[model samples]
Target: MKTLKRLIILTTLLSLLSISLPASTLKASPPHKNVILLIMDGTNSDILTLSRWYRGTDLQLDEILVGGVRTYSDQSAITDSAAAGSAMATGVKTKADYISMNPDGHPVLTVLEGAKLSGYKTGIVSTSPVQHATPAAFTSHTLSRDEFGDIGEQQVYQGLDVVLGGGAAWLKPQVKDHTKDDDGMLKTKQFSREDGENLVTEIGASGYDLILNRDELLRKGKSSKLWGVFAAEDISYELDRKALKPAEPSLSEMTHAAIARLSQGEKGFFLMVEGSKVDWAAHKNDPVGMISEVLSFDDAVGEVLDFARKDGNTMVVAVTDHGNSGLTLGNQGTNENYKSLPAEKFIEPLKKAKLTVKGATSQLKKDRSNLKEVVSSYGLGNLSSGEYRTMKDAKSMDDLESEMVKLMSKRANLGFTTNGHTGEDVFLYAYGPGRPSGLIENTDIPLVISEYMGFSLKTGKFADWYVNGEKFYRDMGFLVEIEGRTSNNPVMVAKKEDEVLRFPENKNFYWRNDEKVGLKSVNLYDGDTFYVHVEE
Candidate 1:
């Protein structure tokens, strides 16, 4: 009788507590130990917003904003990945297409290097090849982003504790993309270094446990020094990873593996993870592909956060370099009447797609007869009447492929201003120590990390005095040599507009007086010439 009475009393107390408490309550956020910097290449603030609307849920970034970053290159309002990545790596912005170097071609120290300086291990993971701009920015310095061979070589000697991604061809080489031998079957691509040295052999010799596939990566997770190469160029986008032959590791898997390997360091480590294909997908305005990349990146971010939360000393940062395709949310389509973008119309078709437009194009190029079948297999469907005519008249396969991508863009409700980077600011997110509270430049990122780690780093300027490029400046109605004019001696201009168009002073624009060029005070024409006379 006494035991029965006690049990009834305990059950009554539990029921009362459940009824009194609300279903949801806030929890404390995580602390820092190591710093994991995640760069979502070529994504936009608007794209993030659109993603939330489509999914009908908060993207989780809603709760993790550290601040925002203005992403401009040293000499232009728009920045490519190379310059943007360079600015984040070393707090200095270089000329467009340059990686980890000043205009003088000197190497700049990166946050990863700083980590190494303090005996902290370092790792870099990307969807792109390891030698791609973002990863190269942390490990190698080169005058041109196109110098893949040089970039690959320099990365080999960086003493990196963990490096994983695609681009085996850059480190090695290949005879031909689709060369054939005496056999009926296609020849297997071989690794060919110009000097006849194998990078794979050399990397293995340096004490790294080389992993070439997903199974290898997972089975060999405890390696102190690990290297993984999964694709000839970039690994497959997360949306298409299901069909990837030889099975590549997903971004989250790589992140977890990298952390496992690097966490063994006596001092904390620094790691950079790039959702690089996000830019590639955005460049083509493939909403479906871009979102897959974004989701994959988010998965990686979650993995990093989990590690950071457990360690209590890791600083996890998430940011994008800049906007691409000028992505905006709305009913942007071929329809005459504008309606709010129906998320289902875009989602259902893409979900049915077997290949990205890029993949379909490559397939069509290999066999012209397969064009119809390939089109049917993907979301692109049949070509437009004009597109079919243009494809017939096209002189080269490259031109035909370009037209296909455009058609694919139209099929989706997404509209693209340009297939390139834009001069827009991107959002920054953090969940650890020293997270900033307001707007910041791309260069300030490293400075913040350096401060938290008690290290000194060089900081990049706002790059307000740039003239875009020589050709661009000329197109902007300037008739002078690049070196002939300086910011102090600004480029002056006269046009039908009332106000004088100048440079540097309005810095955000190539030509501005007191306001934007199209505004009433500053109208500009194609042939108008600008000059600046700084009279004392």
Candidate 2:
């Protein structure tokens, strides 16, 4: 009887020890430290291959591919912005058309929210409207991705640390200019609909310093938050925007600015930067435009890579949601001049002339002999007289685009299908800590990030949990004490009941709101717990 009782006690003690030890103590080290997700919307794999061929050397992306992974989702092959971005933001795959909402229209938790709960600062930057699909997925949970107005409103309430890029008009109320419309219907229509307060004003009121231009963004400031808007809609493409605003910051500039601001947090941060126009150019089946956009996006990638290399712990990922316009390399042409034309020459003259295909063709006929010279210069010498006549009558941009395709096809061996998305799988590149050693699917993105951040998925629901330090625990449920040290030194304690507590300089921690009384030291203790109270 005595032996049996002793055995039972031993078993109970062993069980308690197992419960107290962390699961990681028996496992391998966790992967990455910080993660930076870069979305290149509507970019296709062919663009990378073509770019390599055109440059006559391998690109930096080729090196990244060696350490990266590529995998598709179980969702629709040709995914829309909302669906694709949501899948990348969250681990689970949902049906097409849902943004951050679940299949049943219920709101789903995103990695951004998860990171915030984990005590990390969060930010989003994009060339598109800050409320646009890709950025929206990380921050807002909306049933309809088309709810731009709602998304814009949610951005303000979320208290995100940083927001940059265009879409200013979406945040401000729409003002109807009756005189500009040249019609009286403006008076009868509901003209003064409130689209919520100006995003700049709301963000300012929420504690961010508003910076409208590049200079302010680069200038050092003490504010913990930042909001910048450069245009009313999506910022113009790199080539076009530079011609318009020489001082306007490029995508790389915006990315660097975001990182600089968010990295202030002691617990680390999560940021999303997007190059959105790659899809727009692909949608038009404009090879020059698409290639230019891809290269511009690559420059931004270089910026992030540089930062990650210095930080050592920052994980950087570059990927596209889906392919567009089924671009293909076609049969070789006989015209030597066609093969000799520089890639820029084919597109620059057309843009410079500002002559629509119909207008250019019409103007060409007025000077009939000049038509051959102009067309031949573009390497479209094979264009028939009938084709020129048809082009002359073209009435709209679409018609001109069609004629331009035909003419360019004769000179350059290239082919494109309908000007829309395709079902092809896009490429993904990842570097830095926490990434697996092999290729991974799109679903693996959220999982890898969550794991690296030390957060676990509970029934695929991450809405309520937060991560702190190397552990992902539930959010502070009822105001428990929080404490941290800067240099991992032994925590100091008060020597006397009336003596002031002194904290070491440069330590980082947060205390309860009510315990923020005057302090002799930076550190203060409430009852048995030491904390450093900080403003949210």
Candidate 3:
């Protein structure tokens, strides 16, 4: 009996030891200390090979791609800005039209919010509007992609460390008469209209240094928060901007400025830098514009990579949301004579001719005219009348563009796919801790970042209430109630429950009784909580 009692005690102790050892071992190790998400909107992976073949220069972005993970969305052959951006931001595959919302229209928390909650400073920098889909999805939650005004407003509330981009009009008050038609809404009140205060000023009051142009941006400064808006719309593509306005700073300059500000935070920072105009050039089927813009964005990537190298622990991930213009090399065209045309000769004389197509055509008729004189003067030898007529009949920019491509292809390979997006697998490159050793799917991005940031899938509200296949807000301890929409009746208690509740009957209840149920009104709630378990 004494021996049996002693054996039983030993067994009980061993059982407890087994349980405790696993628990101790399961304690997660610290995650990567720093992370940077680099977004290259609509840049295709194939563009890298094409750039080296045609330009004789390998892009810096290509260097990162050599070792990084590359993946595509599950459903679409091609993805839109909203879908791709949302998937990357939230780490889940969603329908194409949704922004930060999940496929079922449920709001999804973003990596930015997760980073912020984890005590890291967060910033968003882009060449496009701050409220544009890519940047907005990472920082704000909205049901529709068209909700720029609301997204812009939400940026202020996010308390982000920095925001740099264009779309000043979205941040400025609308002049009743000057307000343009926005998504079918007539001019009423401007979403951002205020007395003399632009969006920058408002953000500045919240402790951000607002810089308007390149000069101000480059000025050395020490501030935790900075907002720079360079244009009223998406900043111009590199070629167009250089031709149209040479004074603006390049994307690299903006990126450098953003990094300088965000790195100053005590805790590490999360900064998103976007190369936005590549998609626009692709949409216009402008090969020259696409090359110039993509190269310029690559320059910015080089800047970030250099900084991340020095910072050591900072992980930088560069990827495009989708591909545009299905660009591809084609067989050589027959414009052999135009191949030797010097760049200066082709572009300069057009400038000197006061050359609107209309003006040039009218002038060409009066004389075989200074047409040859103008061409030869610019060093482009005399052209036949047939060639002159081809230039004369250029009806749209595309007509003139096609001729230029044929001419330039003789000197360099050119490619195109009508002006539309293609469903091509994009590239993702990452360096630093928590990044997988090899290529990963698009859905894996959020998981990787979350692991690095030390956020368990279980800690997020969405993870438990929705993702875990469990009931929602009720588990968080809030009463579920349905208030009638379009009816002025005061919200009366619709239902009450002790355990987790599901308000399947009222999908729009939270939308109506927002103030009462604490949608945006309060910062904290008291209630029984459900814990979700996720791998770090």
Candidate 4:
């Protein structure tokens, strides 16, 4: 409440958005267009504030704190990521393991599917495997989120405009290695799906451009349908990802690319971007890792906000599915009379961990590996005998990582009650058109988006207006023209060579002649050369 109170008091926080059209204007049934929903899975208000404070970066999401949302699952108050995300995606309560379905196991349409059906382009991006619960709920449906193979099948067959994330193992082929110890270290790993279809290959065969690394992502064709998978499973946690694999794009980069591709269409778009590993880090109770992940997620939120600020019609929703591990700043500090303490000291020791707990634990499974040396690298050499055994003999990666994180928590003076989600409501923020107001139920999420579309646009019509190089102002009324070629001009938007421009005002016509005269643009890429005049 302290941090939230600060946010409420700060005038700058609420200044991110102008007031929406008056209540009277909304009665006209004016259609709302683009929407971007960003979920930081398994996060709570504690992580949000600490990340903003420790990282020292000005996250734009902090300036738009709208309210909080209750996160109870259909069957229980203690909601897992799958159920919480499903509630948001489908506007219905669901069982703990379900994805995009009602509690009765019936397939419920998601806002993404609604957008697709209504002719709006759809996309999803995540730091975890795309088949993971958070991202899965938006575009795929199943009684269980564990159905990774099934989820991957729909990810391709559904033919979204853009899909980017890790979790390539679900869609691609893999061979098992039995030679290694079977202590559940995934030593014998295989990923070829049971259906025998390699969706990664099929994605390219189906005319979608498949990208595997950061460079390819940035250089991907704007006109090409895109499917980019950065890692085999979860993208490495932010703490060690860049240092270990520089080629993989960050969360913000993926968000930017997904928007770039999806926004190519005139019908508008619905995109869900998840900073998924925040929950994983939280589940392990690794405050340092959690902070970095939160900051990373917030960076992506900043990207979406940047786009929304420029494109007046877009709405941005930022929320966390639930809280995790019951993290607090410090037990030594209390209300009102709390002593000022050194947050940097705690944050600095976390810097010693070069790899995520999961990554470091995997490195220790080798024959000559010294657990002491491995733990020491993360400032955890003081583990007790029982704690040491718990770490060394961890039955699964989750156990191994959680045990290691517990050890690290002691040194940092941070306390964690459990290794799973807590029942607490989490922070939810919004800005721009169709923003959710006040405190809301988690199930109200999809409805907020659904209602914003106002009515389904069968033809995906947008009132696109062209500017003839003079001054133009954008309100929340329509889709306006993009950039000219002038470097200093704010009106100049980057144009791709193979772009197919849609002019909805002219019977939603597809304009594709770049070098042809009388067209709005040409191959020479000169904004002034080809100008379309307005007839009044």
Candidate 5:
């Protein structure tokens, strides 16, 4: 009788607690040891069909199709990468170009940051520069995606286990070479950072093995920390890389390498891999480049899925940030006989091309007199008189490349409505223990991952660790000023009686009256406020 009375009291207390809390707060599940998030940036759902047709087989993504995500920003119907990526990184929607900041302009903890706080290894891989919007949103908190210098520095101090992508140029400030190009004009390669701080040196000092080329990345052995920057900027598109054969590594190669390094940790890991250039190709309405990128991303997906299946304790989730270019398989030309038309008409035209429009344009001379020969040589065949004239009168390199791809797309029956992002739901794919299914909001992605990893983003020590530097000091009666607002380096200075604290913008260590104090996470300046992790 006493045991039955105790059970009744326990049930009554649980019912009362459930009524007091929100459903989201009550949701919980078993945690996975590892999770891999693959994002094909700016890919439309239809591109999967195009990829399937191009390969004559179903994709690794097709097998794990779970649901869809509603892609939109806090204020706009169509979301840019920064906002979309931020929504995925943090479980909140913000303005375009914002990274990990909420609509209220406050820095929020990301899933990766939360994972790090929970003692899990973390990494980010992308075909674009690692400091680009998608990857930056996960690892750093900033007001603008254009602030590559701040983002890059924060990432270095963020203590990520593995970071593999392009953008080595951002780590070092711009330096004039006083050299001339092939046209006898002075060539100036301007880097993005204004601080004059060489981060590559700092990365090495921080106990990371710096890898600059594909061979170095491939030959890398097991290590706790790895930083590989493949190119000066965004890596080449797959088709363009196939033609040019640059020394950069492919997305899958980087993913494979990151997993190899991250798996060495005992606490498990959270890895985000992005096929970053599909959006660029879609913005130009280049179908061939889009197809090539989608295929390349699928190859990376295959690598992730293989690992997840083998490990059994890992979860793999793949999705796109938003739709772009409104790519369709059939255009108005096929309207008359849509059902009767064979796949050969579409597949054959794309097969004839060996290089992307960008690659083909690179072969053009200064005068562009070899446009026809270059176009024909890339397998587009002899251009018509009207097509040649259209490309000949193009205003800029961008225009020339767009026109060339447009002409090729017309022959391939690929239709693109606009060169901008579209407001639409993107397909979601997942595989693992406790994978999310059914329709979900874009912001729910990180929440699902948080649940899968057994962490609480809504209420946790992660948020408490990062305090607003100015507010925290000001409340303690110290005078504070965030210096260098416009420059790449911003320092938070707090002054009190016979004591002062100097927190440099992106470094993990701060100074308290000549003594350096280290933090577990980096100090961040998000254009308006500075965030620093304070130990309890």
Candidate 6:
């Protein structure tokens, strides 16, 4: 009780102090009409150097080089994408696997959400599942990143103007004999709901143009809202996307389409574009795949920069959430001749490969007898005797791919220290109006973006919009109780007289007695407490 009193006193004093400050002391929102935040997931700073060398030309990202951003979470030094992305989205550091939630497990408004509330069109585009960690942080709030169905559903009701990516499977109910692994075992999948809710149908019914393929996206009719889900899981990597079934679009294509649609609004827009597979390739320690993904992301950056330059009122900021795969130019093999080695030694070897390690691995049979023949067709041949034996004896497909990546990386004289995320500062780039420069914390992202969006997270608006559910309801003469405290789908029930309201966690709707009520926002709970949004 004493601690709570002190906190209340501190808040009151701060509010009084703010009220006493001069008008100039409070920085006004910038005059920018739009803001675009592009995240190249799991990209290391060194990857830029390698990609530039591979392309033999300067990337569009080179023109906007600003400084760097420190990437760390509230709990761990080496942060995962969910926590890292949430820090950038909400301007607060959080625990791993948390999407737009604070360390105390309460919902915090994201920059995109705030932009929407401020009357700006908002959108999110990514190469991975839109419900994947990085994109999910900007679009939804959840305690666990693994809550794909919940995240997918929340995005549909968040009132965004545009959303394009993969993970179509999560929106539909599971089908028998959907897909199988090499062992003929049914792979685990997460579909819409345990009770079978079809969110894709709901999206169309909610007035969004539901697109399924590249042709549909290109020839899309004029619509106020657009939602495209390209694949069952993540869309294919850039190197392997050419042969992908259903003909998915490139990352740049998605970015271009999103920008075109989002900019039509008179009030401006906020869009987040993510090259999500760069991290996936780095986790495999495949330099060729990583380079391919980076180049694709750079192309998307080109599209963003082009739009920002032409508009002149848009603020463009691009940065990676975190670093991965400690990739270095010279490996142990080049220690003695590192300085003497030409750029061709690194660039030429990677150029020979036409497919990513994933694409090559997909061509191999169960027996693995055609490892050499299959890899040779992909321009990754000449494996040493020991390399052949190791790959042949690999226990699983994952093990085989790892070995293949190591051998290919060795041949290119490239080095990778680990297959996991690294704790490092990532390069930050920006262009046009209201671009932040110098070294900044990842949490500073939303604060910077909010400055251009005509809102302030530091003001009383945040506390008023998202309130402590139990206290707020109790103050209104209602009794509150929580159900499913241990399950992913938790609900907070409030009762007063004959009025009863049920708020489900991580969803955009609630129940009043027997009637279903849809909300423009989600109700958040961090295990112990519930945070509800108050409509203005």
Model 4 Cα lDDT, one tens digit per residue, 1-536: 99988987685555533355465664665444899999988887777767776666756777889888999998998998889888898788889998866775555666787777667888999999999998888877666789787677766766688899998888766734332342423355666776566666778877877888999999958454789988878787876677767888999999999998988877688999999988888777888778878888888988998899999999899998988988876654334323655676456566667766755655565542577776765657667889778877876556666677866775665667777889987777999987996889998888888778754312222112123322221232233455423431213222245443432111111243353223221111122321222322
Residue 338 C-alpha lDDT in model 4: 30
- Tens digits of per-residue lDDT, candidate 6, 4-61, equal 9999999999999899988767887554489999999999977788999999999889
Candidate 6 lowest-lDDT run of ten: 175-184
Q: Supply candidate 3's per-residue lDDT for 291.
A: 63
lDDT of 5 at 15: 94
Question: Best to worst by TM-score, what's the order?
Answer: 5, 6, 4, 1, 3, 2
* Cα lDDT tens digits for candidate 2, 1-536: 99999999999999998899898886767433567888888877777666556555666555576333343434665677787788878865666666665564545567786787677888998988887888988887666677666577667666778888876766666632212111111232222215334555667777887877878778877898888887666776675555545556789889989888888877788898889987887776666556656767788888888888898889777888777888765434434545565555433333332222322333243324565554443335555779778755566435645676566644446667768887776666778887644556666777778788878544543543221211211132222223333322324322233333333221333222324333211232222333332223
Better of 1 and 6 by TM-score: 6
| Deviation of model 3 at 61, angstroms | 2.4
Residue 256 Cα positional deviation in candidate 4, in Å, after optimal superposition: 0.9
Name the weakest run of 10 consecutive residues (lDDT summed) in model 1.
Answer: 518-527
Candidate 4's C-alpha runs over 4 A off are 1-32, 173-188, 332-340, 368-373, 379-403, 456-536
lDDT of each: 0.71, 0.64, 0.61, 0.72, 0.86, 0.86
lDDT of 1 by residue, 1-536 (tens): 99999999999999998888776533333323478999999998767765665566777666688678989988999999999999999889778888877765555667787777556888999999888899988877667887676567657756788999998886654532443332213456664555444567768888999888999988855459999998877888876786644498899999999999998876678999999998998877766677778888888988888888788788777899888988654335545644655666545555556766555454553335566665655565566777667655555555654565555555555567877889888888998766665788998888888787767775332112112233454565755333213332234443434545444221123454566432111111111222221211
Rate residue 96 of model 6 by lDDT. 100
Question: Candidate 3: misplaced stretches above 4 Å?
Answer: 1-32, 53-55, 66-75, 175-198, 332-391, 394-413, 457-536
Query: Candidate 2: how large is its RMSD?
Result: 15.7
How do all models score by TM-score?
0.73, 0.68, 0.69, 0.73, 0.90, 0.89
Which of the predicted structures, 2 or 4, would earn the higher lDDT when compared with the native? 4
Best by TM-score: 5
For 1-536, candidate 3 gives per-residue lDDT tens digits of 99999999999999888887876476865533667888788766555555454355677876766344333443576777887788888887777767666776665677777787678888888878888989988876566777665567667666788888877767766622222231212345434432233555567777788777878888986677888877766776665555444556688888888888877766677788888877776675545555666777788888988988888778778887878877654333524544564444333322222222211222232323354543332223455677667745655434644544444332343456556777766666776656654556665676678787778543545363323212344454556443332231212232335333222111112222334221221011111211121222
